[model samples]
Target: MTQVALTISAEADLIRVRQVLRARCQRVGLGLVDETKLITAGSELARNILTHAVGSRGGVRVEDVARSGRQGVKATFFDEGPGIPDVDQALVDGFSTSGSQGIGLPGSKRLVDEMTITTEVGSGTVVEIVKWRRDRSWRP
Candidate 1:
């Protein structure tokens, strides 16, 4: 298992996150489509950290994982900013506290195989997402 952690303190870090995620996804043997999905999701989350968590500590950890002979990539985004007051509402398609398109969280979830968010009103938030490589041998 390989792991890399990067801090998201500026706009440039978002690009770095995408680059690292893309490399890790390719190393895990994920195809172009899956890699794109994961990188998009990671970019959204990393941007969130920069946009919403400014002046606070935020970052993402990307790791290569394997389970049941399946290869996958996992990313965990964390921040020490004001946490989401309403997680359910935040997950809604059109809910936005910052007045943007409000698709970051929900859209990101759709791009990954699994996603989970843990947050507190005052403490902070942690979002973990995983995308598993498609098994080429499977047939309908």
Candidate 2:
């Protein structure tokens, strides 16, 4: 169940993307706190796509997934920029290429149930995350 898919090309786009993620998550039974986490995580990833990717060229896709009897929301942020030179270092807290607090990557990870990163130095990056609904599990 792909709930939201859209292009994020600027700061303005980021706001809309986060709003959609929040609304979709809430509509799908995610509690307020869970919705905030999802939106926050999505915001960080989406911001990275804009800040690091070329021309802020990227897109976001959020979907509803029920796997292994667990229900969750999945969000993927992809960009065709100069890929992350060091995925490991980037994931480390306090590491920022753009010179900020550097909590975006690691903090986003903490907000989600699972996260995976795929990137190539000269190519691009794709970050996917999932947040499960612990109060209820999906059967079938």
Candidate 3:
């Protein structure tokens, strides 16, 4: 497994995060559409780190992963900020604590194959997302 880690300290870091994810997605044999989806989702999460976790320890880790003979890419966004109070409410499309469009979390979830959020009220939040390549030879 190959991994890349980067700090989310400024707006510039968001760009870097996207670039890293794009590269990893390609490395994992993801198609252009898959790459776009993963990169878009990554950008949203990186932005969340900057917008919601200002002055906190925030970072992103992207890596290549495989499961059941399938190749995929995974990105994990973490921050030591005021954790989410209500995860279900936060996932709602129109929900926002900072007066934004409130689509980051939900939109990202739709873009990835799997997404998981681990958060505590006062501790922090960690969101992990994965996108698997569609195998042409596999059928369910």
Candidate 4:
């Protein structure tokens, strides 16, 4: 496994986080479409870390993983800000507290293979997502 951490505290940090995720995904041999999906998901999540998790304090842990002969990229994010009060609503598409079309969490979920999130209303939030490598013969 290869891991890197990129801060998600500012708009500029979004670029860094996306860069790290893109690189990690490429290193894991993700295809063009997969790379786009991963970067898009990472962008949405990193943006949320800045917007929702007020004060824009948080970071994303990016990694290239190999387990049981399957390889993938994983992104784990954490923020010490007022967390989502309703995780369910947060996961629902078209739900947004900030009111900007509300597609981040749900959209990201569709782009990745697995996702898990934990949050506390007054404490913080954590989200982890993974996209596994696809078989070369059938990938497009």
Per-model TM values vs. the true structure? 0.94, 0.92, 0.95, 0.92
lDDT of model 4 at residue 91? 86
TM-score of candidate 4 versus the correct structure, residues matched by position: 0.92
Report the lDDT tens digits of candidate 4 across residue range 1-140. Answer: 55898778778988898888888777778888888888899899988888888784699998877666778889999999899999999889899899789889999999998899999888899999898888643322
Q: Give lDDT per model, in order.
A: 0.91, 0.85, 0.91, 0.85
Model 2 accuracy (lDDT, Cα): 0.85
**Which 10 residues in a row give candidate 2 its minimum summed lDDT?**
131-140
TM-score of 1: 0.94
lDDT of each residue in 1-140, candidate 1, tens digit only: 55899999998998899999999888878889999999999999999988888799999999987778787899999999899999989999988989899999999999999999999877889999999989745322
Best by TM-score: 3
Residue 35 of model 4: what lDDT?
Answer: 85
- Which of candidates 1 and 4 is the stronger one according to lDDT? 1
* Clash count for each candidate, listed in order shown: 0, 0, 0, 0
**Candidate 4 ranges with C-alpha deviation above 4 Å:** 136-140
Candidate 3: how many backbone clashes?
0
How well is each residue in 1-140 modelled by candidate 2, as lDDT tens digits? Answer: 54678898888988988888887777567878888998999998988888888574699888888877667789889988899999889989999989998999999999999999999887889999998877674243
Error of 3 at 94 (Å): 0.6
